[model samples]
Target: MKLIFLGPPGAGKGTIASRISKDLNIPHISTGDLFRKAIKNQTELGKKVQQIIESGDLVPDALTVALVKERLNNPDVENGYILDGFPRTIKQADSLESFSKIDNVINFVISDEQVIQRLSGRRMCKNCGEGYHIENMKPQKEGICDKCGEELIIRPDDTPEAIKNRLAVYYESTAPLIDYYKEKGLLLDIDGAQEVGKVAEATSKAISK
Candidate 1:
């Protein structure tokens, strides 16, 4: 079924979306992944996107919408697709509605404080890009990668101020979608504080019902 997964940074929406997409045999259509793939492939759209990004400007909504439409038309999407990181604004939601209505919108809820801890403590491996956290999930050695001897580094985006800014921007544009979909009775809010499996179970129940 067509679904939208919405949540703040470090909420594990991407992880849950990937798992759900596999279990339901649907394409996991994430805009972030889409952009990365397109850029890596050097497609026409990618060239345009790369130019915009190089200029330090946000990719225009129209281009993003067009790219999504192209992906949706793929043969693999015949059954449905799970949307992650799309519809960042009400305008994008409107554009999506013009194409197709969403069956369910799953929102993972967590506090701001929790979000900071989850993101800020994240450490990335210097060698293989494996990630670990100071808490919840730690490495075999402090400040060192288990698989590789390279020291782990905190990603720039993991800073508290950056995360707070991201949360503010998300709430400003995305918080409204919760109400918009709730009015249509298609919204499912789940506690993101739970384990990933538990969250996935709740999401599956919502999608099934």
Candidate 2:
């Protein structure tokens, strides 16, 4: 199953996709991870990506498409794969269609308030980069990392204002792909506001059919 998981930031697409990847025996390919790997390996494309990222600019569609194309050519993807964060725009989606046929696009639907609440409550360990949540996954001690005994800090991007801004950007850029895939009869909407287990169950059921 060639799957694309789509959602606003904090909608838990990554979490659900990781679970589904293991259950379905497919690799979960995130574009962010691809970029990081490329940069770490110091490939030519990686050099360009590093420069673009250092300048605080979004990578061009052509460059991103090239990266996805290279990844899809790997032998492991011959069976199937879950794409987590590529094709964020119609142009990118079009580019994807040129090289691969996506079986379905799972759209995780949640409201802006829910997104803000979920993201703003998240905390990360200063030392080990472990994650915690204020309401959902609290540590043994307040504001402390259970694993490393370090202080937990809210990422700057996890601030309420930053989350709202990210949602706005998501709506502006990636939301249209919902309709794009829906018109092709390949979009599945899942209620992401539900508990994580419930949401995962719903997603599995949706894709299984």
Candidate 1 whole-model C-alpha lDDT, 0 to 1: 0.89
Q: Which one is best on lDDT?
A: 2
lDDT for model 2, on a 0 to 1 scale? 0.94
TM-score of 1: 0.97
Please provide, for model 2 over 1-209, each residue's C-alpha lDDT reduced to its tens digit, 9 standing for 90 to 100: 99999999999999999999999988999999999999999999999999999999999999999998999999999879999987899999999998999999999999988998899999999999999999999999999999999999999999878887898889999999999999999999999999999999999999999
The 0-to-1 C-alpha lDDT of every candidate, in the order given, reads: 0.89, 0.94
| lDDT by residue for model 1 (56-100), tens | 998888888888988998999888999998888888888999998
Model 1 Cα shift for residue 186 (angstroms): 1.4
Model 2 regions more than 4 Å off: none
